[model samples]
Target: MGANFISLSLTFAYLAQSFLFDTQVYPDVVQYQLAIEGQNHTIHLEKNRDLIGKDFTETHYTKDGKRVTTSTHE
Candidate 1:
């Protein structure tokens, strides 16, 4: 019984350590569609980007066919 308890304790400790550490889960970027109604704004949850920290909402419409994006804020 003691041997089984020690083994269980060790397994629990290992699992606890693994959960506490910062495992690098793949970083991600998400795009959101902003809906504005007469100065009121509502943010919507969109899809995730394949590349981490990528800007998915870059402006594509312009008089000269130009697209630009500012700094990303979380």
Candidate 2:
């Protein structure tokens, strides 16, 4: 019974630790713009490092979502 109690306590501790420090490694795009002229344009973005220390992605999509471009500055 003591062993079972210890195991349950360890389980709860592990669960608690997992919940406490969980964070998303994947950064998202914080800013974007779009202009669709009689076509379907969908832009999906992710993170790229900036010199001014702002967190935003350099990825861009154009030509009816058929092209992908990356830039140092948007």
Task: Indicate which candidate wins on lDDT.
Answer: 2
Residue pairs clashing, model 1: none
lDDT of model 2, residue 60: 62
Distance (Å) between predicted and true CA of 4, model 1? 70
- State residue 58's C-alpha deviation in candidate 2, in Å: 18
Once fitted onto the true fold, the runs of candidate 2 whose alpha carbons sit more than 4 angstroms away are: 1-35, 50-74
Sliding window of 10 residues with minimal summed lDDT for model 1: 4-13
Worst 10 residues of 2 by lDDT: 4-13
Q: Could you estimate the TM-score for every candidate?
A: 0.17, 0.20
Residues 18-69 of candidate 1: C-alpha lDDT, one tens digit per residue = 5568483532322233333324333333335555564445445578877765
How many backbone clashes are present in model 1?
Answer: 0
> What is each predicted model's overall lDDT from 0 to 1?
0.40, 0.43
